[model samples]
Target: MHLVTGGAGFIGSHLVDALVESGQKVRVLDNFSSGREEFLSHHEDSGRVEIFRADLLDMNAVKKSMQGVEMVHHLAANPDIRLGTEVTDTDLKQGTLATYNVLEAMRMEGVSRISFSSSSAIYGEAEQMPTPETYGPVMPISLYGASKLGSEALITAWAGTFGAEAWIHRFANIV
Candidate 1:
């Protein structure tokens, strides 16, 4: 079984579709802050998809959702960068703290593998057009970017300390 956080959003919902097509059972944990249920409505009858409407900030809810999960696809984050500026802690709470909860819950549940949806914003104001993977001196210009970098750090730390498997994919703006 696969667990996808923010699985009702555009990208996450599409991922759930692909997973279901591959004959895998998926558990979707989403808060609906930005995720729309209609995106995942197609899967209602399959029984291969289970939707858990909960926030990642809730440790108990996160833990409960992690039950019997094999792999985790963590895509939940504050999608609005401008909103982060208005609410200073938006990114910190939604991105960093939420990621921490997921990792901690995973630790307790003994779920090792996690695939994180990171962003190219982490390489803020890069000198090059397409920043290299080894780009240095990452100085994020936005709170959203900083939160992503922080979440990535946390994931790496969890992997190193607990022997967990992690895949951090830094996605660029789509078209």
Candidate 2:
């Protein structure tokens, strides 16, 4: 089974669709803060998809969701950059800290694979228009970006220390 953290959101819902179409079982964990149930309503009757309405901040819930999951597609985070600026710690709690809880839960559950949705914002002011993943001097401009970078660091550390496999994708505008 696959676990998609933000599976009710735009991108996540689509991913769930693809997974279901491929005959894979999926478990979605979302808080509905920026997601809507209607997005995933199509899979309601499909027994292949299970929705877990919860937040990543809840450690016990996160660990429970990890049970029997083979891979984790972590996409939950603060959706609004403006909100992050207005509420200073929104990104910290929702992004970085939440990712930590997910990783910890995975560790406790003995799940070793994760695919993280990162952001190109990690490369703050770059000289190159299309920054490569190997870009140097990552300087984030917003709290959201900082949280993503921190999450990336945590994921990296977790992979190295626990021998887990991680795939971090830094996305820009997803039009």
Candidate 3:
């Protein structure tokens, strides 16, 4: 079974649909914050999808979702960049901490594969347009961006430390 965090949200929901269409058993862990149930309502009738409403900050909850999971698609985060500035702890709890919990859960579950949805925010205002993957001196201007960059680091470090494999996809904007 495959696990998707924020699986009720815009991107996650679409991903869940595709996974289920391919006959994959999917487990979705979502707290809804920005994820609307309407986006995933289409999957309620399918036996392939199981939705678990829980915060990733809760390690036990994250662990529960990892059971029998072979791969993880982690997409949960503070979606509002402006709000992240207004509420300083949003990124730490929702983005960074939540990601940490997921990684630990994966470690305990012996799940070795993870895919993360990192954003282009890590670049801040780039000096070089068309930022390459090897772009260095990453300076994120917002708390949300910092959290994303931190999460990326955590994933790679976890991979190096624990022999886990990871795929980090950096997207620009989600419209």
Candidate 4:
């Protein structure tokens, strides 16, 4: 089974849909901060989907969700960008630190593969429009962007140190 964090949110929910349609068993761990239950309501009885309502900040919760899962789609994060500006610690806890918790859980559970949801914001208004993934000297401007970049770094280190594999996607604006 594959575990997807924030599986009830916009992008994550659609991911769940596709996974289910493809006949893949998917388990979702979501705190429901901005994720609506309606997004996943159709899958409640689909048997291919299992939902766990929990926060990634709790390492125990993350570990529990990791049980018996082979891969993780790490999509959970604080979605409100403006909130990050007002609260300095928001991204640190919800984005960066939460990713640490997920990585640690995956490590202990022996799950080696992770697909992290990074963002184009990590490029931080680069001089090169339509930047490539190999763009040098990544500098994030917003707290949200910085946290996502930090999470990407953590995933990279985890992959190298633990002999795991990771796919990081730098997504552009949803709309």
Candidate 3's residue-wise lDDT over 67-128, tens digit each? 99999999999889999878899999999999999999999999999999999999999888
Model 4, C-alpha of 56: deviation from truth (Å): 0.3
Q: Which sections of candidate 4 miss by over 4 Å?
A: none
lDDT string, candidate 4, 1-175, tens digits: 9999999999999999999998899999999989999999999888999999999998998999999999899999998878998999999999999999999999999999999999998989898988998897889999999999999989999899999999999999896
Candidate 1 lDDT, tens digit per residue, 75-163? 99999989998999999999999999999999999999999999999988999877988998888899999999999999999999999
Better structure of 1 and 3 per lDDT: 1
Clashing pairs in 3: none
How many clashes would you count in candidate 3?
0
TM-score of each: 0.98, 0.98, 0.98, 0.98
Clashes of 1: 0
Worst 10-residue lDDT window for candidate 4 reads: 129-138
Instruction: At residue 74, give the lDDT of candidate 3.
Output: 99
Question: Which 10-residue span in candidate 3 carries the lowest summed lDDT?
Answer: 39-48
Model 4 TM = 0.98
